[model samples]
Each structure stands twice: as structure tokens, then as C-alpha cells.
Target: MTLTSIPIALTIAGSDSGGGAGIQADLRTFAFHRVHGASAITCVTAQNTLGVSRVDALPSAAVAAQIQAVVQDIGVQAAKTGMLLNQEIIATVSEQVAACKIVNLVVDPVMVSRTGAQLIDDSAIAVLRSHLIPQAAILTPNRYEAQLLSGLEILTLEDMQAASEKIFELGAKSVLVKGGGMSGELRGVDVWFDGNACETLTTQVVNTPHTHGTGCTLSAAIAANLALGKDLRSAVHLAKSYVTTALKYSLAIGKGQGPVGHFFPLLLSDS
Candidate 1:
């Protein structure tokens, strides 16, 4: 029998007790793409589909320790960060990045949840813009987050393009502004600005309420694809497809908004 080595991807994010978004989604997305996932949790969020009720951040030292443990031993090919809510954690992460020099960083600027709860403090926006965005290989921000980062209302596709450009100007080498939250039939169009040209990644919007963890999943899936030796564009394409597929088979679990079935492809259907 022959055994092949699976590449590792690290996720530095908060924990969602609901097992829907944040670290849980990241791990599942990694598994789906056949990549090993290591996690260094920045915070533990207390909430479900309804909304994020509370968030308790981990100490800077502890966060650094987790990243160090993974980097010094297990190692990682690529890393994704979601929900780094404070400056201290973000700064600590930046220091670790300089120390480890792990390439292929996908930063999901998770400022607010889908339910409008503040995942990050307003003061830390500057920290993220100056520190984290520059350190990332790619920045994935949704429409609302793009607006928050770029200070532009992403009302149309053109606005998304402008926002992506603005975000890149803020230091993101590459930017992908997810169009899921935008009103109207955009087909969940996502705009990617790679510092030179704009690429539109469009997929039919799935009519599923189980849309939580999508940003986390996309970022994680992109990391997984990168670990498997795929280039940036291919990685984003595959990640988008994976997220769409996951949403199509999402399980309606919670009362407010459930989760997309991470292992949906393996689920046995009644049909």
C-alpha cells in the first residue's frame, strides 16, 4: 500500500459554539479539500444562528503559543485567519507571521456577523487595515465588510469593483469582495482584484438560509487548494464552487439560520 502526504493548513480564528462558522467551518472546509487543518483560536463566541451574543477573546500570549506550537512542529503550507477581533491578537499574529514566514495567507476580515452583531471593535479597524491586510496574500471581505473597509457603499457590481480597488490600496495585495449580502439577483457574484485586473467569479445564488460560515469556508477552502499546489485563481474558483455546493445541500438546523452541510456530498439523501 502507498501512502501520500497531506499538506497542512492553519486557521487562526474564533470558535463558534454552533459548529457553523469560524474555526469549525475552517476545519471542515480543509477536510473537504483533503488538507490537514491546524487551528489557533483567537476567541470563543457564544451564540447560534440567531446572532452572536458574546465573545471572549483569548490572551495574546496564548494565541501566540498555539501558532508557535503548530509552526514549530506540525507546520503549515498556507494559513487563513477569521475573526481576529482585537488589536493585541492581530498584532501578536503579525509578529508571528514575521517570525514564521508562512506563505499563502488568506485573511477573512470578519468584522461583523451575518446577523449584524459586531465581531470586531471599531477602533481595531485601523489595526486590521494597517497590519493584517498587508500581511495577507489575499483578503476576502463580504459586501458589508468591503464597505466597512473601503468606506464605500457597494450597491452595484461597479461599487464592488471600486471597493476591491480601495481595499487593495489599503494594503491587501489581492482582494475578493463577496457579493452574497448584496440585495438583488447578483447570483452571489464575487469580485477579485489582483492589484492589476479585476476577475469576476459568479455562481448562481443558492436559495438556502443555511449561509453561515460561507466566508470562513471560502477562505479555508482557498487555503486547502493552495496547500495542494494550485495557484491563486484556481484556488479561488474551486473554493467558490465548493462553498456553493455546500450551501446547496445545507441542513436547516437552527431556528434563525442553520448551517451549510460541510459533508453534504457524502450525505445519503431520501431521493
Candidate 2:
């Protein structure tokens, strides 16, 4: 019998004990796309649907070791970073990414929440902008994050386009300004900008409160598609479609908010 080799994707993120976001969601997204998933957890969070209670970041050396272990042996076709908790970790991860030469990188700048709240400190954000983001093949930032990065207000599609361009100037090959944090008709309308072209991507809004891991899932889906040999634009579109379908069947578990159903096809079959 011959064994077939599968495309592999790596998720360098934090761990969510609630099983809604971070490494958990990324791994699930990778599996759904039939890509072998590797992970290097950056931090451990004690949280559930309601909120995050505690977060303990791992040592920089430990995170580097994990990356080395995976890249040296198992290998990865694409990689992503979620929450690099602090400056030290972010800088370390950035260095490791450069050292490992992981080119197909998707960076979900998890610096702000969908509600416009900042997640990391100024120093960490600075280091992430200076180091890691420039190496990204695709930089995915939510509305608030886009605003912070571009120093502009994102209230319309045009604003999103402009923001994408500004972020693209930061050295990322491409930029995606996510609209999950937008309001009215602008919501769910993402803007994509490469060096040459800028476009808006609209998908059917899956009205659900259980959107805990949508950001992580979308980025992971992008990485999975890249691992499967899709171009950047096609990868983003397919990933958006996958997230939309998953959102349609989003799980309604836990108290505050659950998660998007990464395995929505199984839910359909079970129903």
C-alpha cells in the first residue's frame, strides 16, 4: 500500500481552552480543508464563551523550539500567527519565521477586538508592525486593527479600500481589511489590496451571535488553501465562502457566544 502525502499548514498562535478560537480553531479549519495541521502555541488562555479570564504566555525560547521542531521535521507549506501576546514573543516569532523561511504566511493582526477594543500594548504592536507584518504574504486585520494600522476611520467600502492600500504600503504582499467589525451594509464586506489592485469582497452575512472564532478560522482557511496551491486572491475568496457556510451553521453552545461550525458539513449530515 502507498501512502499519500497531504498538504501541511502551521498555526503559531495561542491556545483557547474554550475550544472556540486560537490554535483550536486554526487546527480544526486546517483539518476541514484536508490539510495536516501543525501548531506552536504562544500563550495559554483560561476563557470560555463569556470572556477571557487569564492569559499566560509561554517562554520565547519554548515557542522558538516548537517552531524549529515542526519546520525541521514535519515541515509546513504555509503558516499563520494569531496572538503573540507580547513584544518578546512577537519579535521571537518574527525572527523564527525569517529564519525558517516560511514564505506563505498569513498574519491575523489580532491587536484589537471586533468591538474596537485594543488587545496588545503599544510596544508589542510596534514590533509586530515593524517585523512580522512585512514578511506576511497576506495580512488580515479587523476593522479596528485596520483603523489603528492605517490611522484612518473605516466607515464605508471606500474607506476599507483606502485602508487596505495604506496597510499594503507596510510591506505585506497583500492586505485584507475584514469587515466583521463594521456596521450596517458595510458589515461582512472585506477589502483586499495587493500592490496593484484593490477590491471589495462581499459575502452573505450569517446572522449569528456565535462568532467567537471567525477571524482565526478565516485566516486558517486562507493558509489551508495556500497550502493546497491556490493563489492569494482565489484563496481569500474560497476562505470567505467557507467561513460563510460555517457561519450559517454556527454552533450555539456555551453562555455568551459559541463558535462558527468548522465542521458544518457534519452538522448538515447529522441533521
Candidate 3:
């Protein structure tokens, strides 16, 4: 029997039909971390490990109503947002989050795909910065998302530090600028910056083709850890470690940027 309590965490985001990212990744991460996971999908994407081909957003009111339904009935200790496609959806989510007073919000600014597809529009970025950033407990942005939000090119560690500062200035309680995309020679670098201090998280980057859901998985793991009562910094640290392990154990599953093994530990134990 498991000795852990199942803390509840919610994912307010899009649905990835491929099961590699978006709401799919959130649920798997929650299960992996022993959280009772709940989700309200805001958008649906026809995506695969290969790439995103089509997107159909849910009505903003429906999205808002689903969030209300989940929070009112089941409740969540922590929540994370991924793939919030449009401004209306962003507003709807922010309104509900405010009304429910649900703290511990982790926002993954998923703007572009690794394969060069634009996952989010420029307008959504403005809405995210103006609305969601202030409400979020943590903001997770990759190099490109960081540049778009902070108006700084995150080429070096110094630029990353400045990006974190600008992100916090936009109102996030804490920021995680994922340096997974930093230029040549730096394979592994992710940074965490709280309002008070910053820490650089490094690992031997897994040179694998299967990294499709890294951002979603990392943010969800952090939310799961937070739901389990870990402090923000502790949550981020553990989440980063978890993502690294997941990537290390990844299976090359698709034609393009494939999925890491979200259930690696479970598979290992079953073996």
C-alpha cells in the first residue's frame, strides 16, 4: 500500500490528443507524483509528437464554467495552467481563479513549439502578462517565451537573470526561466528566481529526440509537489529533478520531437 496522501491539483489548459502534453501530461504527472489530479480543458489541439496541426478553442464561458464546477465540487490544493490559447480564455480563467481564491498557480507560457509552430498568438502574450502573471504562484517560460515577455534576449546567464527580474516585475511571485534552449555548449541549464534570490539548476542534458512535453511536465510536477505540501523552491527543485529523470528514461515514440516517459518509475517498478 502507498504511504502517501493524494493531494489534489487541477490543470486548466488545453487537451493534447497525443497524450504527450497539455492536459494529458498534467494528469500523468499528477499520477506519477501521487496527486489526485483534476482538469478543465480550455482548448483542444490536433497535435502529435510530430507537431501541432490544428487547434479548436472551447468557448470561454464553457471553460470558465468547467473551472467553477471543479473548484466548487472537488476543490484543488494547487493548480497549473498550460496552453491557454486566447485572451477570452485567459480572462475567464483569471476571473475564476480570483473568485475561488485558489493559490499556488503555476503558469506554463507555452507559446511556440519545438518544431517551429506558433502555439499561441501575440495577443495572448499581452493578456497573459497583464492578467495571468499577477495571479500565478509560479511562471515557467522557455527562452523564447521569456524573450517575448521580458523584451530581452536570453542568450547568456546574465540575460536570463534580467528576464526573471522583468517577469517578476510583471507580477509573478516567482519565475522559472527554463534555459533548456540556451545557445551552443550549454545542454542543461534551468534557473529559478524567487522574489528574494535565484538559483541555477543544471543537469547533464539528455540528448534524446523525445522531449515533446518537457514544459508541461515540469510545471505540472511543480504543481503536484506543491499540492503535496512542498514549499515553492522545494517544489521547483524536485520538479526539475523529476523532469530530468523522465527525459533520461524517454522512449523515442514519434516521427518528430517525441515524448519522454512520464511513467518511467511506474514501469520500472512493474518490471
The numbered model that scores best in lDDT is 2
Identify the superior model by TM-score, candidate 2 or candidate 3: 2
lDDT of 1 by residue, 1-271 (tens): 7546779999999999999999999999998888889999999989898877988999999999999999999788999999888989998898897799988999998886544466678767778888778988899988778888888987899999999998898776699999888778664899998898898889877998778888899999999999999988899999999999999988788788888878986884644
Each candidate: what lDDT? Answer: 0.88, 0.95, 0.87
- Per-candidate TM-scores read 0.95, 0.98, 0.94
Measured on C-alpha atoms, candidate 3 has an lDDT of 0.87
Expressed as tens digits, the lDDT of each residue in 1-271 for candidate 3 is: 9655558999998999888888998999999998999999998989887777998999998998888888898788999999888888988888899999888999998876543356677787778888888999999988888888888877788888888888889888999998877766544587788888988888777888788789899999999999999999999989999999999888777677778799998778988
- Residue 113, model 1: lDDT of 57
lDDT of 2 by residue, 96-130 (tens): 99999997999999999999889999999999999
- Residue range with the least summed lDDT across 10 consecutive positions in model 1: 112-121
Residue 234 alpha-carbon offset, candidate 2, angstroms: 0.5
Give the local distance difference test score of model 1. Answer: 0.88
* Root-mean-square deviation (CA) per prediction: 1.7, 0.9, 2.0
In terms of TM-score, the best-performing candidate is 2
Residue runs of model 1 more than 4 Å from their true location after superposition: 1-4, 115-117, 268-271
